[model samples]
Target: MKSVLQIGKKILLVLMIIAVIIAGTRSIGMGMNIRTPKNGINVSFYVDINGSNQWINIYGKDIDNPVLLYLHGGPGSATSPIDYSFTRKWSDVYTVVTWDQRNVGKSFDKKNAADKITKDIMLADGKAMTEYIMKYMGKKKITLLGHSWGSMFGANLVLEYPQYYDAFIGTGQCVDIAENEERLYEEAKKWTEGDEEGKVLLSKWSPDKCDDTQALLARSEIMNRYGYGMMKDGRDYNIVATILFNPNYLVKDYISYVKNIETSMEPYMDFFAHGLYECSLLGKYDYKVPYYNINGDMDYQTNYEMACEYFEKVNAPDKKMYVMKGGTHGLLESRSEEFSGYVHDIAKRMASMK
Candidate 1:
């Protein structure tokens, strides 16, 4: 009887150990398997920026044709392994370069990042990445497409280094920091009032309680539940989930190309808390660049009005604003036939100028 009991205990211990190993592997395996499109051109990516060696994923065929060096949103959101989303279709027209900025994605080893992140370090990184892309591809000029946080960086990049880009496209353009905060607060208010779960969650979103990461994440989840409603069919969470996580990001790419919110999970969360708040990347507005501002009127994140205000006020040699009707921030749908056409039209105009 004693031997049998001991044997049973030992077996149970083995099972528990096996379970833990599986759980541990799964936890670290999220982005480990993600791959760049096999057929796409892969650049010999390297950059010495902010004391970190950054990696680059150069997609598409035509390096000579105006490359759209896509700066992704997260002060840290990466571009590689997920290049399929933002650079599709444009790939045929332009050699799209997706840069995984320092401290994000597979770019610069995290060990290089110090105790605090600064806008200077971030901007220096962007400048270095841009210089590297131009030198690597041997392209004298390229277009800059900045999405969300990417847009913020795009604005600053062009302001500081207008000589590099032939044109600039700002999607989900965040020109005002206070406005974004208000937009988020309002969204939170609406969700709390209408969404029962949101109300339950936000009730606990007090600063004191949300001081920690876990509490803050719970608050963000509640906000996303309400925010995702901006999608057309409404309950496309599975499709949305796939948009963010699936390995084959062809559809995800299309979705991101059209709609702008399908961000990788970690960057999305970190940027929201630290980058958005700490990065002094907005509110100045007064700038000059060949700028085309695109916004989905239904975009709640940056709010269409704020983008328009920048277009109205900012001094630019060539400035145009296109408001996609019925389009939310992530307005990449075939249904937005006019919107897609407009993009092609703008590209043609720029190409013609080139």
Candidate 2:
């Protein structure tokens, strides 16, 4: 009887150990691993602005060619890893500068407050960072490529300081405030009503009282899944999301860094989310920059049609619209080959005049 009891305890301990190992492995695997581009030089720096320091990345082949300072979406999104995947291809031709805006990623911020992380603060930090990058690289001008929320900031930068950028390219651009919210609401509604699964899933979305918090949780169901259908071929989002969530080489490092960031300063993440959720109302400004708007055929996040309409009215001498056949904003990394090709063409065309 004593021997049997001992044997049972040993088996239980072994099972418990196995369960812990499995759980630990899964927890480590959950973070996204975004890859940096190849052959390009990765540059990092801290820019001091109003007693605060911000971090920026520059993906350039060499100091001789033109450079595009790439502004990432998510006022707080870190573009260092994913921007490298596609921009490195353009490095042979032009330099690409990617940065984590104030209170984001590697930028310094002991406390994250939404009020302090306003668009004005971001633009100010971006301008300071841009000036620092230009001075550091010994370059006069750079092309500006802003994705989603980045476009919002880029727009303000160009309008306020048009002479700073040589040319501008906006991906997943957000132009009108009211229209975008309506589009998102409608998309969610359609997704919820279209399928029984979607209906059951989004049953929590009370259109009348759904705030940003409610919308955030429900976003995965409507945007993540329905995004698959809106893609040019229905599989683009899947491929991109997969890569963002589970990258081969860059995933582990990126996640480790992200975990450090989150653990060290959780308020930063909260501030970022708050800014993204509430900053849509700041989109009523007029633009005065020469720009190109790039849209994926299947992107429903901000509605391609609305973007097209705004581009048509944009007041710039050198502006056009470029569409990816079956791409989404997330494709910037997942579809690196195609994305690199697009950047190459744009760089070549811009370089021709120089």
Candidate 3:
């Protein structure tokens, strides 16, 4: 009996060891399977911007493919962590680059005061980063893709330096900020006409009356809760889970992702609240490069109508607007394949133009 008990204990110990090994493999395995193709290029590094370090990841199956620099949304939000989900496929065709804009994500600086960061500074950083990427890849020009707040930044960059880009793609494009906000506010009110909680939350802030960023933040929270933002058909996607499981992010990077949002929100809120309205290029109608606006028909965040309006008015050497049916602000995630195909088609057209 004593020998049998000892044998059982040993077996239990072996099982525990096996379990540990499996768990360890799974945790690290998240990124292990990710590999660049032979002759492909994959690089993750930091670039200096105004004496600060900004993080960027560039990956592609072929180094010779056209470069596609993606500008993530969120004046304070970073998309680098989730790039693997969708952008990886894009990398197969184009050298896809994702950057954590200053004051956000891995690039967040606790020592950098909020007052020092502004819209112009961020734009300058983007331009500098583009120049660096061009030089690093031995490419004179690259394609620019921006989403949400990124669209706003990319629009400015393409307008100012059309010579540096082969094409411009704006997803969830922001045309007029004040008008979009007003439309959002009205839509929120309309959607909540039958719901008491939503109305109460929305009533605390009026789009025209409330210029406070906190109020806008509150309004957005309420709207998102009602599935007016990214959620569609009562289906909820866990973005936090997506970020946590990102293989490229370490424990410290994850912590910074959360902390940076809080640290940068106040400064960024003011900029987003006012800058989009005051400096919006709603009336500007001409661009120097091939421009494409791919938008979700159901997107209320940036107002799809405004994007269509801007696309109609804007004149480019080559221009097109593709609307995804029943799509929302999360169109890139929901319809990544379709979006990628559009991008490839546009790239082909761009190559032919050259």
Residue-level error in angstroms, candidate 1, position 79? 4.4
Q: Model 3 over residues 193-297: C-alpha lDDT tens digits?
A: 888988888877776644476576677777677765664643233465556456668777877777667776666776775665655877777899888989988
* Number of the top lDDT candidate: 3
Candidate closer to the true structure by TM-score (higher is better), 1 or 2: 2
How do the candidates rank by TM-score, highest first?
A: 3, 2, 1
Model 2: residues >4 Å from true position, as ranges? 1-42, 111-115, 206-211, 227-256, 260-289
Between prediction 2 and prediction 3, the one with superior TM-score is 3
* lDDT to native, each model: 0.63, 0.63, 0.80
Clashing residue pairs for model 1? 73-150, 85-253, 258-331, 258-332, 259-330, 259-331, 259-332, 260-330
Q: Model 2: what TM-score? A: 0.73
Model 3 regions lying over 4 Å from their true place: 1-23, 31-34, 208-214, 225-227, 233-245
Candidate 3, pairs of clashing residues:
none
Sum up the clashes in candidate 1. Answer: 8
